[model samples]
Target chain A: MTEEIIIAGFGGQGVLSLGKILAYSGIMQDQEVSWMPSYGPEMRGGTANVTVILSDDRINSPVLNEFDTAIILNQQSMDKFESMVKPGGLLIYDPNGISHHPERKDIKIATIEGAKEASELNNKKTFNMVIMGAFLKIHPIVLMENVHKGLEKSLPQRHHHMIPLNEKAIKVGMKKVKVIHDYKKLVAEE
Target chain B: MEEVKLMKGNEAMAEAAIRAGVDAYFGYPITPQSEVIEYLMHEEPFKRTGMVVLQAESELAAINMVYGAAACGKKAMTSSSSPGISLKLEGISYMAGAELPCLIANVMRGGPGLGTIQPGQSDYFQAVKGGGHGDYNLIVLAPSTVQEMADFVDLGFDLAFKYRNPVMILSDGAIGQMMEKVILPEQKERLSNEEIIKHYGNWATTGKPESRESNIITSLDLKPELQEIHNQHLQNKFKTAEKNEVRYEQIQCEDADYILVAYGTSARISQKVVQLGREKGLKIGLLRPITLWPFPKKIISELADHAKGFLSVEMSAGQMVEDVLLAVEGKVPVAHFGRMGGMIASPSEVLDAVEKEINKI
Candidate 1:
């Protein structure tokens, strides 16, 4: 199986770091992975995004036009990537600062109040971890233990002290996610 | 011990140079490739391996410094993007003329000038067809994966020394910025000055003793007759390399009706196209040229006899396609598909292009 994901947000929202963690987790699980970031001036306070691929087989293209999942954090990203999701795929977003919500009926859609959860925890840096937690709750592609190992490997030794706090933030996200649309449920209703 | 890590292609190149026993690194910072020097500076290779890593005042100065260090039989390298590479062409030409051995990595961006900071493969002719001047060729290696970005550092240096010519790692920003798992080779000890004399004293400007005549390293000969001979010597050396160092990979080509030829970033993208086409029963294959200078012409010529058509995919405006056409010699229909100005073509688009050519056939 292969999971192609795009995580997009402002540069300081930990978008790239979240993708790096997921890539590291894939490595820990002995799966092939690739991480390609949209770099350049856009990285300086502008909208930044990274394309991440995790697969049971060798990955062919790191730069893809479509994705199985899109984890969007801001309205700009939502506007850009909501239409890029493959049919029967998933899209998860943070519902803060988003003026127009996703309106797709063909895929799964969910929202996690990442900013609110981070503010409640009194740590804005854990925003990405919360979002990651929400993603894992929806689709547990990787084991929790591997995610912990990935966090350890991604962060430097000095940052190890904050792993517990990040873990707490992720747990909060998993509990707080709201599923707005499910294609399978819609099909059953029809 | 072998170590595995997820690293960007540029960072892997720097770490590989350090692990390959490189004696010095002289380079100026440039976008899409500055990570090579930044990683080197952060790692402090001087402290770990006694290697010198210097940020030269300019691209010109950096390449000249490489010339100075490499003349003494030391392993030296430099890296830059398109514009910065243009600035180093004079030094590169001189190095080729003098028959010096050193590694130059060009992480290319879009350009005829300062076009864009995005990745592009437009420098194909500049690298493989003698970028600077005269009839000199650089052994150009195109790496499609992060692992090759590391492995080719050692291989480039080896080819440079073996042929007494300059070697180039021709990559683009896409591969340079992307991250993937790489199994890094073990650290190798730098050669001592005494060892240098023992290994390359025949030509290198190591200290001269009473044992033999002084070694002179120069591309200058005022006499026209001897200069022609020197040109012939360089040509013969290039011919030998073309015979012995051609490297390429063919995937699913045994019974393919169409073939896609590409290198570096374009090759990775076309590999996806190959899979996409095969799923639809199109019988497509891909040939990736690992060495751009000693291009896999012989194999391509052979493939042209059987394959109904060929599609050359690139990030340029049909540069390598010229060589593809020359190799195929009109044996089959040849088409070119690409996206310029840093825009990459998608797998579906490339598949459509090859399918169009096959339909015509």
Candidate 2:
């Protein structure tokens, strides 16, 4: 199985790191993964994006045109990546800065109030982890145990003490996510 | 000890250099490749392995520093991007002329001059065709994955010392910046000054030893005939490399009607094209040149005899296609598809190009 995902947001929003964590989690599960970030000038306070591919087999290309999932964090990303999601795919977004909500019908849409939730937790750094948790809740690509392992692997040794707070934020995100549309249920209804 | 870590291609290359027992790394910071030096600085290989990592004033200085260290029989390396590499051409030429064993990495970006800081294979001709002014060839190894980025540090250094020639790791920004799981090489002790004097004492400038005559490292010759002879000697070394060091990987080429020739990042994209084309019952294969310089002429010529057509995919305005056409010798239809100036050609676009070439056959 292969899952092509694009995670996009502002530069300091932890977009690339979120994708990196997901890729690392895939590695924890003995899966093949790639993390391709948008580098150069675009990453300096501009919109940042990364294409992450996790596969049971070898991943051919790190860059992809379309994706099975898109975790959008801002309005610019939401506007740009809304149509790039494949039909019957999943689109997860933090509805904080999104001016125009996704209007697609063929795919599933889920929202997590990541900014508000992170602020509520008094740790803005955990915003991306919240969104990651929401995405994992929708599609359990990796086991929760592996996510903890991935965090330990990815975070610096000095930041190990913060993993517990990040874990709590992730669990909060799992409960806070609201599924706007379920493609499977829509198909069944039809 | 085998250790698996998720690392950027640039960082992996630096880590590998330390583990490979590299003596020194002199480099200037450049986009998409600065991480190599940054990693080296943070790791402080000087403390761990007694390896020297210096930040040079410019690419020119960095390459010249490499030349000086290499002349002393030290395993020295330098890395840069396209524009920075342009500044290093003169030093590289001097190293080639003097037959200095050193490693250089070009994490290429779009370029004619400061073109773009994004990933591009535009340096294909510049790298494989000798960017410097001389009748010489640098052993060019193209790495598609981060693992190879790490692995080629050792391999490139081995080949450089084997032939007493400079080697280049010709990578693109995509591979340099992307992250992947790499099995890092085991740490090896850096060669001490006594070891350098022992192994390379004959030709190296390791002070005048009473045991032998003083060794001089210079590219100058007062007589034109003597310079011609030196050129011939360098050419012979290149010929030896062509025969012994050519490296490539063929994917599903055994039973295929169409072949796609690509390297580095383009090869990664072409692998997807191969899979997608096979799903549609279109027998397409990928021929990836791991070593771009020894050109893999024999293998491509052999594939041309069986394949119906060839498509050269690249991130430049069709550079490597020239070599492919030369190998094929007009035996079959060969087409070129590329995206220049930092834009990457997607897998579907590569498949479309393949279909367009296949339809002609």
Best candidate, TM-score: 1
TM-score of each: 0.99, 0.98
Model 1, span B100-177: residue lDDT tens: 999999999988799789999999999999889898999999999999999999999999989989999999999999
**Model 1 lDDT tens row, A1-190:** 8999999999999999999999999999998889999989989999999999999998888888889999999989999999999989999999899999999999999999999999999999999999999999998888889889999999999999999999999899899988899999999999
Docking class of 1: medium
Which docking category, incorrect, acceptable, medium or high, applies to candidate 2? high
iRMS values for every prediction: 0.7, 0.7
Task: State the lDDT of candidate 2 residue by residue for B1-361, as single tens digits.
Answer: 5688999999999999999999999999999899999999999999999999999988989999999999998999999999999999999999999999999999999988999999999998888899999788999999999999999999999898888899999999999999998999998877776887666546888777697777889989989999999989989999999999999999999999899999999999999999989999998899999999999999999999999989999999999999999999999988899999999998988899898878887
Off by over 4 Å in 1: none
Give all candidate RMSDs, comma-separated: 1.0, 1.2
Please give the C-alpha DockQ score of model 1: 0.80
Q: Under the 3 Å rule for N, CA and C atoms, how many clashes does model 2 have?
A: 0
